[model samples]
Target chain A: MMRNKALAAPFVLWAMIFIVVPLVMIVWYGVTIEEPIPYTEIVQPDGSVIYQLEDGSRTTEKPWQKRAVFSLNNFRRMLEPTYLRLLLRSLKVAVITTAICLLLGYPVALILTGRDFKRPALWLLLLILPMWMNFLLRTYSWMSILENSGILNSWIARLREAIPALDEWLLSMGVRRRIIFLYNENAVILGMVYNYLSFMIMPIYTVIEKIDKSLLEAAADLGASPVKSFLRVTLPYSLPGVLEGITMVFVPAVTTFVISQLMGGGKVPLIGDIIQNQFGKSSDWHFGATLSLLVMVVVLAFMGALGRIDKDDEPHKEVRIL
Target chain B: MNWKKNLRKAYIGLIMAFLYAPIVMLILYSFNNSKSRAQWGGFTLRWYHELFTDEAIMGALGTTLSIGFLAAAISTVLGTFGAIALFQMKRRPRQAMLSVVNLPMLNSEVVTGVSLMLLFAMAHIQLGYVTLLLSHVAFCVPYVVLSVMPKLRQLDPNLAEAAQDLGATPMQGFLRVILPDIMPGVFSGFVMALTMSIDDFVVSFFTTGSGVSNLSITIYTMAKRGISPKINALSTLIFACVFILLIGVNLQDLRRDPRKGKVEKVRIPY
Candidate 1:
């Protein structure tokens, strides 16, 4: 074992250089801001200002240079109301998505794990196959369904034409000819749930599928009803999986830019979108790093809390995306 | 009781419809003759033809596959050795190492992406294929290690020692005895790493330089401008490939043991 322990040295080194250093780099970028170097402005005799540099070199032009110096400017900016609102909006969306996924996904997992259910593998595969497709494509496909003039709207329009009285009744109730389903906060949540539903189902299914049947029988023998047995036995056993599912769905939901981008149509920008903007259009890596540090801390805090609750569960056996 | 069964069936059907509606819409619209997404002018295969001929899409596909392979290969080797080493270490050190390995997988992709981007910027390494591949490997190695670990745990620790007792050198013992047992895990890990690399968007989006993009990035940029039927066409093709690959892998496992391999990759991580 001692001799074989040397085998991991290369991987350890790789992890340190890649995994550890990049995080340290984030912190480095997070805590720092570019400040213009202080200079002594000397009024030149020729009606021009000369700048005295830090090293006492005189230049005819004003010194407008900035250096990356340690400052909490980015952190302070992060605390601004605009950024705080974005953070709150992102969390709100993520929480909604997680709740929706749990509500929708738990039953799917329960049904598939039922003893009466045949070929659960095939069913699970059917559930996960869509995820195997390109994630961007999957999100993009929703546009066709939910867009104002998209399929759903078109179908509703046709139905309204076919039933004129019903259409007039709907018009009286203030229903638009074409529903604006896409490009909003709810649309973004829909995208998240559609994409991440399997992530919720898979873990819950895995844990519930492994729950001992005898425990249910024992509960029944104790005069517990089916729902009572589920509450007393199955629910308690599935807590770890539920937590895992929530983490899986919530973290990605919170951190997602793509779903928000495509579904929200830039109308509903999450913290992820803002962070991406800082890197892309904004070109504020320092600010982006600050936002990223905030996201990382929030996500880590969440996972750490979940990890504590499910500490008795084997951490290694938590297979993500399976 | 009969109604209960019917209710379950109906529930499953409803969920399936919700899940498949978008996918079906994409597949249906791929063959659309009209350029507009709302109306179906007529059925045509023109989009698929354009999908193949489109230079940007083809180029991105090539880059994606090449990076997927290279990253998977590099990570599998690194992770295999890392897993073996971790298995041999004392509990405290092993736990520490495992948590470090989990960081990239557990961390938000945006954070991981930016952090790596910063690292590359600091190192003065130009972002392109190399940085993209490196980041993919970095994130992917953990999956490989996790996949292979259970296999290592299942292996009798003395098997390698027994091979040594039979006059085999440590490397030979490892190659013959330990490798065979862990091959399934290694293979699965390789496939896992490959799929992960291919499917990745966020990490590649940040790490890749201009004029170099994977399919996901290509699709993202194209999609942002508006919907293109060509993307729908490309989605159909990718979906077909994934479907076949997953079915083939699972079927192979089923053939090996009917009772086992019920799920695609229920690899029990140790």
Candidate 2:
């Protein structure tokens, strides 16, 4: 009993410092103001330049001020349509990305567990290894594939030299116009789907591996077709994975501005983009905190509702929760 | 049935191809000797050489490695104790604590990043290595706990009971009896924490204050400016490292853990 108590003290201490305090602080800061924008310099492409910006909002004499008061303006400003639109964009892309990830991941997982592949080890490695590399690095990789001067364009140009029909088709169809799709929500969806697909797979595979083979055999015996048996038996059993996959993909997808900005361009700001603007570009840490806190609340609410609904049919209902 | 079976086979092949295609493109582009980033000039080792010599990239690599090591170490100690505490508890408190530990893991990386940024900045604290290390440890604890908890669950509780009956202190029972059994679990937890710490950028990005860069940050800045084969070189290196680690883990599973092992390692690895 004494040893157990000693062991538990460390866990509680670490949790309070690292997890609980940080999360609570995010809320507390949401209601307070921080620095205003620092100085700015605008340099023209030619050699001329102009410069301007306010001092840190909390400070007065071009230096750090004493005793800055807390302000609520940051929270109040989030109601603007422009900001809300960004939030909606976050929702739209997150939903689409998560939906696509489920579609792509589920079919692949089904095939993996349903039948033995020639090199099962290799397939599993392929699924997992991309996840272990740098997240930003992988996101950057897609840039080469999607950009105008990148692989597809080069390939088309090569094909143009060899095949007149293909060259003419490429010229006529103008497939190069895909460069225009850059900085759009589709890019966000694609990036999110690619990044989080494995999360979907791991959980689904966990559940799928546990499913009794007899259940599938019984479904087949009932005279149901292959697809029907899958829909009724396999899909229902895998809902736990789907539940986890949604939260895993959706929250990041919605809040991620980097993938969208780098891949999609800064044209369509998601909630993440706006929050980033507040902190990095705008120097409105207070506003960013407000936006971030709002996102946390929404996530909490979204996850809470999902938990309530998903709990109804979870396998080992006690073990899995958000 | 024959046609349907053929279609299924084709579908599986297509999926595999899709999975393999992007990585292959990345590798092929890394060797594209041109600076245009678009046109593939020819195969060359030029960029890899460049990546090695670049001061900024190297600096970022150093930061990433240091943070990864620190965070992994912290996660292991806390996570090991947390897992054991849950195992020893009666029931309800254990369940609640386990759930709380898992909560951070379930949250999205972007959300976690943003929340940490707010938390750090609000406290009027500097956001640098400190925040990054703290948040990394926070998320990694769950992975360590999850990995260790399963192995703990599989052990026969009777062994510990027997150890106690033989005049062993609780500490002695755990150290001599439980530690040996859970060493593999601890190794797995360490592996997961290390990989996660290395892979993370979003959390690090938000927590890291201005100018203290890591590899992912440097790569991100470059990519933002424009696509560079330099980044391709970096990606290739990262991919190589991950590939080796994945192979190592899979090989270990094959040799060591029956449930995780596949048919490939009927042979030996010394």
Candidate 3:
């Protein structure tokens, strides 16, 4: 018994140092501010002249002389309209991406798990294989495909050159010769869905695949049509996976900096872009910590709600066909 | 019924295309003889040659693989032992520990990255290999724990106890009984940790200093200056390696447990 406790000590210590301490540091930095530059008047060598102490503070000053003070300034800055808009836009884009992924992925998952589907594992592996590639490489490839004068546009140009009437028709429609696809919110969402669609598919596929076929058979025996059987038997059982999928897609979509940077071309700055700026270009750690805290709270609240729904479905496990 | 079946198959085909189109573009463009991604001049292996010889990229790849392996191996040991200890612990303390374990998994990656950056800044620790390794291990442990915990829950509680009762020492009982039973979960956990570590960018970006950059960071920095086709070649090679490895593993599993492999058509759930 004592040995078991002893064995746990190292991990516990590690968690406290790395996991617990880092979070505490974020909170600490978030709610605090460094002392602003002190202003003082100094007498110059010429008695009539006065000097301002701008560049240099006293070298002998105690470290506590420039103490960090607790402040709500960082949080207050977060409420600025620009920052708030970015947060709202991030949420909107994430929500849209998640919705699109579910719409596109759920059907794919269902079909992949179909009774007649052969070699489902092989198909599933194919779906997941792209994800193992470097995420940056994946997004960069999208840039190559979607950029103005890139593959799609060049193909369109070729089509127009082949058919003069097509060129005239496009000109008559007031559309530009080249369609610009990058550096916009739509491109960011496209990137998100592309990168995260597999995440949505995997979880929902796992859940739907686990559904007992006998339950569907039972539903059919009761005269339930295929759709009705699906509604009653499959949908309810797959809710946990759906919620899991949503969390998986939505969290990353909301928080991804690289996707927006690469695909949006820094034109559509999300909250993630802003937070990254604070740490990088802006160099405002306090403000960055505040934004991180806000994102953390939102994610936790979202997961907690999903977790409740998961717990409520626990009693229904016995109804599983397996 | 015939149409419904055809529709299902077509839908799967379409989604597969959607997922694979970018990847296919990447692989194709890797062989393009042009520096411009927009134009395909001709087919060539120049990028592959460049990929092999680029010292910066090769160094980053070395760093990434070392970090991935080391972090995964260390975290697997910690997480496996941690899971076993927590399983034996009382409910309240176990719940508390488990939640902490889940924190890194559930939190936003941005938050995790920023918080770790803050910790290093406050502690005045230089953000380099050690910080990178620590952050990787910290985040990777949760995945390991989650994987191993399920296997621990499924074990017969008295398996180890029975071995002990048979006059085996407690450590011997654990080695002979519990370890073998949990090997599958441990193996998966290690793989999961490795994948997460390798794929990581955001946490590694912030936690690692400029001198110590991983492949993801290298790619991100290169992105601003237009990603070279060498990256595409490298990715194509990686994809091929993983694909062959997966096929090999599946074949091995079929050989070892033919019946079980046939019974469970879908071997991995997540």
Candidate 4:
């Protein structure tokens, strides 16, 4: 037993140093403010400069001196209306993306696991193959297809040229021949759904696949309709997968900077973009840390709610899929 | 009933098209001669030729492969051993350890990326290949642990004791009895680690510096300036390689258990 514990020591130490400490550092930086050097004029030759402190204490300090202090200023800044709106928009986009994925992915998963479907593994492999490509490159490919003068519109233009009446109707409806699809919130959502739909499908497919066929046979034997069997048995059983899929999609969707940057073109900046900017171009580590902490708290709360749903279903068994 | 089946097939086809349109465009544009994505001047193999000769891209690809290989190999050993030790622990302590292991898997990539960046900065470590590799290993360990734990649970606990009773040493028991049983899980863990390491962008972006970049980073930086057709060519080659590799792995698995090919479930952790 003693030797076994010793064997795990290195990994435990690594986790503590890398995982635990970095989290603590985020919280610490989030709450603490770096004291800026006070502006003061040198009126005397005694090496003293006057500056006002937070407590309104007038002090004469040595030139170029600064002190760190605890403050809620970063949190206050995070609550500003601009930041709040960005957070809200991010939530909205993430929710829409998750909903769309569930609608599209659930049916696909059901069909893939159906009795009539052949070569399910090959189809699943096809679904997962695109993920192996560089994600940025994948998102960038969408640009060529959706850009105003890109493939889709050019195809539309060719069709319109063949049908003069349809072109005239479109022009009369105040629609431009070239539809600008990129650099908007809709484009960002489309990009996200394209990237994350696979995640939603895989979990639901696994859960539905794991459902014992005998249970459904028994339901049919009991004279229950197919829809009734589905609702009573399949739907309830797949709640865990649904919750898992939601977490998988919502978490990344809300926090991803890459999709929004590539698709939004800096116009529809989300909270993630702001957080990334603070670290990259803005160079405000403290504020960035605060935003990260905020995101972490919200994510934890979201997971906690989903976990409660899971526990309600299977109270005794500890179900951890991920 | 026939129409219902046709409807299902058509729905599957539509969704598959949605999933594959961007990928299809990437492959098609690789053969396009024009530098502009919007135009198709002619069919040309110029970009494919350039891809082989581009030094920066070749260097980035080298870094990505080496880091992925090293991270996966190191994390698999550590995580396998860690899973073994953890299996011996009491229930409460084991759960606690497992949760800690899962932290990296659950946390947002951006947070994990920035936090590691901050850690490296605080420690005064140069942010380059070493830092990037360390962070990759750190994140990849949790996946390995998760993958291996399920297999460990499926194992027979008394097998090791049975070996010991036959005068076999602990090391001998582990190598001869335990290792063979857990080979599938270990293999899946290694594959998962390698895939995660290679596909990673956000964490790698934050933790790397001194001009050391991976394929994802190179793509992202180039994307800002409108990605060249050479990238399209490179992506096509990569897709072909992965397609072949997937076919090879599936064929090997089918050879092992021909009847299970259609119904085999990939044992992903989540």
True contacts kept of each: 0.62, 0.39, 0.65, 0.52
DockQ of 1: 0.52
* TM-scores (chain A) of the candidates: 0.88, 0.79, 0.87, 0.87
Candidates arranged by DockQ, highest first:
3, 1, 4, 2
Clashing pairs in 3: none
Error of 2 at A137 (Å): 2.5
lDDT of 1 by residue, B1-270 (tens): 989988988998999999999899889989989998878889999999888898888898999999999999999999988887777666667788888888887898999899999999999999999999999998889889888888876777677767877888777877899899999999989988998899999999899995899989988888867767887888898898877876776566666766644543433221
- Per-model TM-score on C-alpha atoms: 0.92, 0.84, 0.92, 0.92
The TM-score between candidate 2 and the true structure equals 0.84
lDDT per residue for candidate 4 within B178-259, as digits (tens), equals 8899888888899999999999999998899999999999999999998878888988998899888886776666567667
Instruction: Give the whole-model CA lDDT for all candidates, comma-separated.
Output: 0.86, 0.72, 0.85, 0.85
lDDT of 4 at A209: 90
Cα error, candidate 1, residue A19 (Å): 1.0
Alpha carbon RMSD to native, model 2 = 7.9
Candidate 4 iRMSD in angstroms: 4.8
How well is each residue in A79-174 modelled by candidate 2, as lDDT tens digits?
Answer: 888788778778888888888888877877777676656445456566766665566666766766776776665666677778988767876887
Can you give the DockQ of every candidate in the order shown?
Answer: 0.52, 0.38, 0.55, 0.48
Question: Any idea what lDDT model 3 has?
Answer: 0.85
Residue B75, model 1: lDDT of: 95
* Sliding window of 10 residues with minimal summed lDDT for model 2 chain A: A313-322
Q: How much DockQ does model 4 earn?
A: 0.48
Q: Cα lDDT for residue B40, model 1?
A: 82
Candidate 3 CAPRI category: medium
